[model samples]
Target: MLWFILIPVLVILLILLISCICIVPQATAYVVEWLGVYQATWPAGLKFKVPFLMRVAKKVSLKEQVVDFKPQPVITRDNVTMQIDTVVFFQVTDAKLFTYGVERPMAAIENLTATTLRNIIGDMELDHTLTSRDIINTKITAILDQATDKWGIKVNRVEVKNIIPPAEIQDAMEKQMKAERQRRESILRAEGEKRSAILVAEGEKESAILRADAVREQRIREAQGEAQAIMEVQTALADSIKLLNEAAPTDKVLAIKSLEALAKVADGKATKLIIPSDMQNLAGMVASIKEMVTDDSAKK
Candidate 1:
């Protein structure tokens, strides 16, 4: 009966001891509270707590986390209403502060983000808001980081996910863009036509110049050929005159040769002729020969 009573007590003690021991995992933190008051933060590995006196209040993750907030209505400086949503990346730095700093930290961050975004957009026009996304993101991240410092939440980055302008404004922008693209296309087409015309004109001008050069060359060749022919004729004439001088012809032979040259000139298409004084005498002598031939025929 004594052994049975001791065995039951040993088993109960063992159960209690196992329940009091806590093992914190990696990238995790445990906030311990003693008698409902803040005590110590337990890190990874084996940890011990006073039995029935201390408890794990909250388990905080040290890893980075992301929160995507819904779209909120905002008005720009130009009084243009638009809807914008954001995403925030954060990590827990101090587990104790994170546990006790604020109630509902995620909700607090969302509200703060919406208010800050409105303030920023209120100072800018619609055009600036649409174009300066990086500037807006940086400004919001800086503000949130400073505000959440006491809460042990480090805001690493903030991003504007989407911005939806009014439907009318979007349609107008699209039409304007279309017109601008058409204008650019027209200008490019006009430039291309102008360049083509210039090329054709240049080609025609070059062709004209080449044709003129070819004509000039042909005329020059013809003139040179004519001059060569004249030179050859003059040389042949000179050779003939030299042979005649060497032959030493008598005056009668010279007169006969002159008569032959006069006969050749008379055969031409010319209507006028100038007779030499010696030619008249030669003609009279030819007429006497004709009369002598006639008298001899009669006598025969």
Candidate 2:
């Protein structure tokens, strides 16, 4: 009977001991509450709590987290309505403050983000809002970081995810883009045509220069050929005169040769003939002819 009673009590104690001990994981924190009031925050590793009076109020993760909020309709300063969504990156700094400072922290953050975004967009015009996303994100992050400091949340960065304008505005933007692209294409084509014309003009100029050079060279070659022919004829005549002088022919022999040249000239169909005064002696001409005939007959 005593052993049975001791065993039951020992098992109950073991169960209580196990229930009182808590093991916190890495990058995790446990907020403890005693008697429905905040007590202490337990960090990673082993922790002990008084059973039946102390309990973990909340488990906070210390890692950075991202939250993407839904799109909210906002009116710009120019009274243009647009939808904008945002994303927030944050980390828990103090586990105790995070647990007790705010109720439903994620929902509170979402509401805060929407309100802050509306205020920022309301101060800017539609065109500015569309173009200044980075500026808006920086402003929002600074505001949120300051506001959430007491809640033990650090706002690392904020991003504007998407912005949607009216359908009429989108159509107008597309038409403007198309006109701009066409203008650029026209300018490029004109530049290309101008470059092509320049190249053609240069090529024609070069061809004209080459043709002029060729013509000049051909004329020079023809003149040189004519000059060489004249020189050759003069040299042949000089050689014939030299051979005749070396033969030492008498005056009568010279007169015979001159007569032969005159006879060749008279063979042409000329209307007139002029004779030299020396050939006016008919008897001498006849005697020379008879002598020429006698010598020819003797040789035969």
Candidate 3:
């Protein structure tokens, strides 16, 4: 009977001892309540609790968490209706406050986010709302961070996931975009044609310049050739005159050469010839040459 009693008591004590041991995992916190009231928060690692007196109330995760809310209907200042969805990033900073600060923390946060979004949207026009996502996000994060301080929640960031305008507005926006694209295309085509025309004009101008240069060069070459021919003729005439002087020609021989030149000039189609003032003297010399020739022929 004693052995049975001891074994039952020992088993009961062992069960109680095992129940007192609390091992909290990393990035976790356990909110403890002493006799149904707030007591202490247990961090990660080994912990001991008073048997049957302290109870684990709430387990709070210290890691950052993401919550995506459904799209909420909002009205812009312009009276345009739109649906906007949001995602909130948060982290539990104080385990005790997270457990006891708010009745339903997640529901509270969702409701707060919807209300904040509506207020922000109500102050902005549809166009402004659509274009100002960053401004909206910053404003909401600031408000939520301030509001949720007591709940031991740190609002890390808020994102406006989607903003949907009405179907009619969407259709109008699409048409506007299409028209803008067409205008840009027309402008680009005109610019391309303008550039092409400019290139053609430049090419023609360059071709004209090259042709002018070639013609000018040909004329210069022809003039140079004519000048060289004239110089060569003058040089030959000078050499002939020098040779004649070296040979020491008599006046009769010179007069015979001049008469021969005059006869050649008279053979041309000219109607008249200008005779030199010394022509009479030249005629007398020529007659003398003719007599010498006749005498030489007789002597031979």
Candidate 4:
């Protein structure tokens, strides 16, 4: 009977001892409370809690986290109302502060983000708001990181996810963009046409220049051919006269040649003939020569 009671008591004590031991995983932190008050933050690995005296209050993650808040209505300086949503990247820096700093840290961050967004939008016009996302993100991140420092929250960065303007404003912007695109297209088409016309004119100019050059070359060739023919005729005539002088013909031969030339002139289509001054003497000479030929034939 004594051995049975001792065994049950020993088992119960072993179970309680095992339950007091806690093992924290990687990238995790455990906030321990002593008598319902802030005590110590246990890091990853094996940890021990005082039985019936200390407890794990909260578990905090040390890794980076992202939270996307819904769109909040904000009024610009120009009184234009717009809806804007944001995403925040954050991490827990101090586990103790993260557990006890605020009632709901995420809710506080969301409210802070919305309030900051409104304040920023309230200072800028709608046009400026639409174009300044980087500036807005930087400002909001700085403000949130500073505000949440006491809560052991580090805001790494903030992003402006979406910005929705009114329906009428969006429609007007679309129409304006369409008109601008059309204007650019028209300008491009006109430039292309201008280039094409210039190319055609240049081609025609080149063709005209080529035609004129060809014509000039042809005329030059014709003039040279004519000059060559005239030079050849003159040279041939000079050679013929030199050959005749070398033969050294007598007066009778000369006279007979002159008579032959006169006969040829008489048979031409001329209306008049110019006889040489020695034509009468030539006729007497011709008669005497004919009488001599008659005497010779009688003797033969």
Candidate 5:
């Protein structure tokens, strides 16, 4: 009778022990509850639980999670409506808070994200909201982190997935951008042309200066040559005058030279040789003197 009762009690205890020992998966934690109230959160690996009184109420994943938000239409401060979509990357930093702090942490996080986006977009113009995406993402992350910190949630990052403007607004923006690019191109071309003109003008000015210098140098050399020629002529004229002054003023040399000049004129290859009127008297006197000398020699 004792053996039968003992075996039944041992089997019941073994079943209860099996149920109490729980194997939690890696990167996962379980929330324990006693009497349907929050008790404790068990980390991953082997854990124990009260067979029926205390059970694993919930299993909270500690791994990182990605939540993508649907597109939400927001009105900008400039009265333009924009459709924006975003994604939030987060992880359960505190398993205890994740299980009890909020009713649905994912839903709460998504709602907070949408509200924050609307608030941020509402303060800015549509153009700013669309263009400054990085700035908007940073702002959202900062605000979300601060807000969720009390709930033991850490917001890793927030990203603006897309900012879609209305069709008409998109068309207008494209046209405006095209016009701006064209204007910039025109300004750049004009600037390049202006620089080229300035360079050409400067080159011309430098060439003109060089040409003037060359001409001046040429004129200076030409003037130097002319002055040298004039000096040579003046020097020759002075030397001739000096020789004439040094010559003997005697009648013999003059008479000899006069005879020589007369003979050269008489033998000249010309039909007529005109003498100066003043030399006519010298010629007659010379003839008379030569005739007397001839007569005296004949008498001797």
Candidate 6:
């Protein structure tokens, strides 16, 4: 009878021992409360609780989490309306403050992100906002890091997902881009035409200059040839006249030359002939008649 009662007591003690101690997964932490009051946080692996007095209030995940804030309509300094969507990457650094400092860290972060984004975009014009998105992201991160310092939420990174302009504004932007592209194309075509025209003109100018130089060289060569020809003919005529003037009247050299000339004029075939009526005409006729008479005497 005493052994049976002792076994029941031992079983109760074993159940209490196993129930108080809990095994938490790695990268996870649990908030523990003692007698309905906040006590301490339990880390990964094995931890002990005060049996029924202490309870696991909440299980807090310590890993990095991404929170996307709701789209906030922000007006730029230039009064352009746009919808901004943002995503914040964060992690819990201190479990105690993360659980106790803020009731809803995600909501708080979203609200803070919206407000900061609005403030940042509000200070920039529409054109500046599109261009300086990185600057705005940095500013948001700076503000969030400072604001969430006490909450034990580390803002790892802040990114602006999309900045949506209105429908009419988007159409206007597209038209403007298309117009700019067309203007650039027109300018490029005009520049190409201008270059082509310049090259063609340069080629024509070079061709004309080459033709002019060739003509000048040809005319100079022709003039030189004509002058040389005239000089040679005049030299031959002067030599013939000197030979005739130097000949002796009784030398018979002129008579022999005259006979040779007359023989050449009547040699081979001479169906019809004309002689100039000048001072040498009668002498030529006399030489011809003498050559014929001399030939007849030689034959006899």
- Index of the highest-lDDT prediction: 3
The numbered model that scores best in TM-score is 3
Off by over 4 Å in 2: 1-12, 195-300
Q: Write the per-residue lDDT of candidate 2 for residues 42-127, one digit (tens) a residue.
A: 99999999999999999999999999999989999999898999999999999988998999999989999999999999999999
Candidate 4 clash pair list: none
TM-score for candidate 2, residues paired by index: 0.66
Off by over 4 Å in 3: 1-27, 33-36, 44-56, 232-278, 281-300
Candidate 1, superposed: residue stretches over 4 Å from native:
2-4, 181-300
> What lDDT tens digits, residue by residue, belong to model 5 across residues 255-279?
6566777889999898998776887
Give the candidate order by descending lDDT: 3, 1, 4, 2, 6, 5
Better of 2 and 3 by TM-score: 3
Better of 3 and 5 by lDDT: 3
Evaluate residue 212 in candidate 6 and report its C-alpha lDDT on the 0 to 100 scale.
Answer: 100
Q: Global lDDT of each model?
A: 0.94, 0.93, 0.95, 0.93, 0.87, 0.87
10 residues in a row with least lDDT, candidate 3: 277-286
Q: Provide the TM-score for each candidate, comma-separated.
A: 0.63, 0.66, 0.75, 0.66, 0.56, 0.60
Q: Which lDDT value does model 5 have at 121?
A: 92
lDDT of 1 by residue, 175-207 (tens): 999999999999999999999999999999999
Residue 55 local lDDT, model 1: 94
> Per-residue alpha-carbon lDDT of model 3 for 81-139, expressed as tens digits?
99999999999999998888999999999999999999999999999999999999999
Listing every candidate in turn, what is its Cα RMSD in Å to the true structure after a full C-alpha superposition? 7.7, 6.0, 4.7, 7.0, 9.5, 8.2
Off by over 4 Å in 4: 1-7, 194-300
For residues 174-214, what per-residue lDDT tens digits would candidate 6 score against the true structure? 99999999999999999999999999999999999999999
Q: Candidate 4 at residue 287, lDDT?
A: 78
Say which prediction, candidate 4 or candidate 5, comes out ahead on lDDT: 4
RMSD of 6: 8.2
For model 4, residues 1-300, the per-residue Cα lDDT tens digits are: 999999999999999999899999999999998999888999999998888889999999999999999999999999999999999999999998888899899999999999999999999999999999999999999999999999999999999999999999999989999999999999999999999999999999999999999999999999999999999999998897688789997666566666678899999999999976887897876875576668789999
Model 4 CA lDDT for position 258: 68
